[model samples]
Target chain A: MDTKLAMHTKNLNFFYGDFQALFDVSLDFGANEVTALIGPSGCGKSTLLRCLNRMNDLIPETRSEGEIYFRDQPIHGQEVDPVEVRRQVGMVFQKPNPFPKTIYENIAWGARINGYRGDMDELVETSLKKCALWDEVKEKLKQNALGLSGGQQQRLCIARTIAVEPDVILMDEPTSALDPISTAKIEDLITELRKRYTIIIVTHNMQQAGRVSEKTAFFLNGVIIEAGLTSDIFFNPKEERTEAYISGRFG
Target chain B: MSASYTGQKSYYGDGMAQNIARRRRHGRVWHILFYAATTISILALIVLLLNIFNAVFGFVLIEDEVPPTELAPGGDLESLSQGELISLLEEYLSVGLIRRFNFEEPLAERSVTDLAALVQVRIVNPTVIEAWSLQESLFQSDMIRAEHAAHPGTRVQFRSWLSARFLVSPQNPRPQLAGIRTAFFGSLWMIIIVIVVAFPIGVAAAIYLEEYARSEIWYNRIIEVNIYNLAGIPSIIFGLLGLAVFVRALEPFTSGTVFGGVDPTTANGRTIISAGLTLSLLILPIIIINSREAIKAVPSSLRESSYGLGATKWQTIWHHVLPASFDRILTGTILAISRAIGETAPLVVVGASTFITVDPKTLFSKFTTLPIQIYQWSARPQSQFRNVAAAAIVVLLVLMLSMNAVAIIMRNRISKQRRI
Candidate 1:
């Protein structure tokens, strides 16, 4: 099977004011594969994920000192617009942040922003269908996004991210706040999503990382400890720290 | 083991121990004190409100029917109660009483009874009546007959003073004859002009400072310091500044006097536009400060999300921030306007008169605000004008309270809509 790298990073270093957050991070997100970044809290996984789309540029004091290439083009190049970059590299936040708008508007927000002049109904329906939310929410698009259940809202956020027609999707702890049923549903959706788009997800759950991603990178204290196929990383991690963290001996 | 355990016991006392029990009692006492202080403040406010109502209503009932006691001449009104007072008043109305009382003219030609009629009316005694009758056989007119018919032989008191007539009557030079019509219209004109001039400017400045200016320290500091200082400035100072700038410097455009051959001083200095501009300046800072706060209060996450979706700064602010902050900004504006309406010192300093006979018709026309009129009436020599002043105050207070209530309702509606 021939697979291409959808996104690649080279020697990326990030700093928040005077404090360095991510040190010499380099990783590739494979096309049509789920890549899970597993780490304890404050281990730079989310920071590295944000660099893929230049979301860190929103913070005034945040500065990065390396190149991040997406589809072989430098994502952080001066020629690229941050707004355009965000449109092509859609993200779902840790918390389900549906805009305080109607469910229909929430799903349609990205399309409208990108000046989608086509039929909104078809686009919204297709996007919701892909997120597995069309049947559940088809009759209630007019209701406020805030009125939806947590699980529904997270799916709505995911649907919102996908509607922008991005090449890659970044989910930062997408199902961390959901119930067991909702988590299972999102895990299934992630597996299904691998058929279409490149997916990079940061997860705290070691089992979730093994179950969802084809490959897993375990990060600890702003450094990647191990990166390998998910089965190898789970069954026989080479690094002592990776084994200790995954086996619940140390976090 | 017993000795070590006893050492630990000193550090971590049991809940049933005396020290821990005492600490818990102290915490409870503090909580009780906090609640007591809050209740005491509320009780004090209630008592103050009850006292004011008692004093106000006590006088309202007693003075509702009498020809307001406040309007009666203070000491020995015997001369004012007599015959020639009506003719004296009528004559003074033609030439202008302000000039006569203040200028001391000769008795033959000087006709008007003067602005101090509450005291001056007593001069018309039976002796003066007999003298005036012999002197003026030429003044036998139906108007005189009607004036006699108007003065029924009822003794005037505080109770007979308040009538529907007081509300609609035009202001007279006499304290008893004075009404709120001119002052009411003056306040109306002032508010209209103020809103017209201030609202757009204040909102524009706020939008610029909050949305467009992104932390350029110098401009931000200037805006921050200016807003804070502006809010702190005594409003009357704005009145003085308005008198200097609008009344004196920009008088040509506002009063339209200096351009054509219009009499500059009469047309320029004491116009409604000047008063309104003064009030606008007085409230501008508050509007800007409150508006900025309202904008700031809108969650930054909302802005980030909008921008993340490729919305421009103006679009984000207009579509998201503005909708979210609309209620707060409106509430702030209403509060600022209410403050402007009740302000007396600045308007007083800017030369608002007490008793203008006619209502202000245009921006450049002569005007008198309610508070200034009340101030002038209260300073008169007669005690009877005091009642008139009180009644005027009641009207002004009612108007102000109603405006505040409307503002509160608007604020509630905005918040309720958001909540729903």
Candidate 2:
């Protein structure tokens, strides 16, 4: 475990209108490592991921109390733009959603909007190649993204995120919508990605958390029940709820 | 369940089979009913089209005292030039008649077609003694020949009430030379103005209402409900609104007086500009409602994707939302313009001149649209006028259908460009 932290949350609470969804969730993501947020449905794992980059602000009447910090400074502090924060911390959704545009444009749009003044063609190519999609889509770069398959579209979304060179990637169930073969490909890609950027993935699959993540956090009822090394959380008993959730006794 | 079904089969005496048969019978009944309904609708449309076409073409019993061929140097007067026709008119007509012709569009300045028409009307003096509808000409031709044999010359041919001459000539009280040129241009002017004034504004308002306005807010809800209600209101009411607003209050602008083009005495605002602005008002609510539906149909996930990439609200709307919805917005606009093109009551309340000889060449020109011309001609007591109105109806139908086809082609091109 490296003591260097990429991002961390301190006693974060979130509300949708009057209903609180996340309560007192504090966790640290190690620099250049993958951390998995494993929880059942309605356990607030995705909600916390959205809060990290202020995506929660898009939902009306949702409020975030407490703080989220990238490096050492709070992301919500005065004079920090949400747009600038999101530029550094990008997100990949549960379902693959690519803009209804050319596959090349889909990856280049983030960079273009964020004022990336460089070789756009090279950026698109490198981003696609980095996500292992360039070989499959090299010939059809100008074709619409919606024509791609589900797995290809998911990979394109990841490529789109990395095109802006974000420091952290927030993936909400990146493989939950994919088939077995696509899921295996993404898990393998995540292992390769861990060397360059910090990754936080929220998933329902406990085995996915065990396979790809160095640190695993178990969430139950809007609160983190246990957070530790993957081996300790999977094999050693810290909380009965953590063991019961991992072993499939009960969620 | 299998054992229960086996036991119950005899208990109810084949009730399961009877129930299935009953359901099948119900399905058959609905299917036949739906089939008959569609057939009736198509049959009604066919009947309507046949009736219009019947009036549009047919036979005419033409009688001329000294036939046109006898007066012209060549048998075909139509092949002559304007100068040659003027010379022929001078050779045939007396000094008094030639003087009267000079009071109107000078014969030298008139088109060759118009001069030839003048010769046929005055010197050749042909009169339509009798006429038959298209249906009669095609089916009862022998009876028509026998019936009109008593008349002089029986100079009857399959004369189309709608002709190339009818399309190019100006509106004449005589249906023989009545043309839709002026009204066609006026309608075209009206549609251009409507598209110009309504499209960008309607789409902007729709985007604001759908993308920016909070639906739960009081003012936004009020605006939304009012727009929906406005779409359903009678077009005549919009005519009245336009009369009060654009026709009266904005008279200086609508009459082109503000542009310093028209004389104040003539700028009463019942001009083409007024009609166009009124029609734009009538079509706006429809365009806005349709555009809102189009913008709404853009999946929210697309917006989320844009936002997740750190794009602002306007950026998301402009980059992703607007482009994806452009095709549908164009469709809505086409439909709205179609409705505006066929509108009569609004143009009527806007004070379209019932009989305007001059084509609408400027915004200040007095105008009459196709539907207005159709309405005016159809109301006349003369049968010829009614037939001519039917011709106008055919032109109007073609205009609308062609407009729809053109718009649909544009939409398909966009779809192919964005094909998934």
Judging by TM-score against the true structure, name the best candidate: 2
TM-scores, all candidates, are 0.78, 0.93
Query: What TM-score does structure 1 among the candidates reach?
Result: 0.78
Could you tell me how far off, in angstroms, the CA of residue A90 lies in candidate 1 after the best superposition? 1.5
lDDT of 1 by residue, B280-299 (tens): 98999899988989998998
lDDT by residue (tens digit), candidate 1, A158-245 = 8888888888988899999999899998999998888988899999998899899998999988888898788988999999988889
Best model per DockQ = 2
Candidate 2, A109-174: lDDT as tens digits: 999999999999999999998899999999999999999988899999999999988889999999
Docking quality category of candidate 2 according to DockQ thresholds: medium
Q: Cα deviation of B52 in candidate 1 (Å)?
A: 5.6
Scored on chain A only, each candidate's TM-score is 0.98, 0.98
Best by lDDT: 2
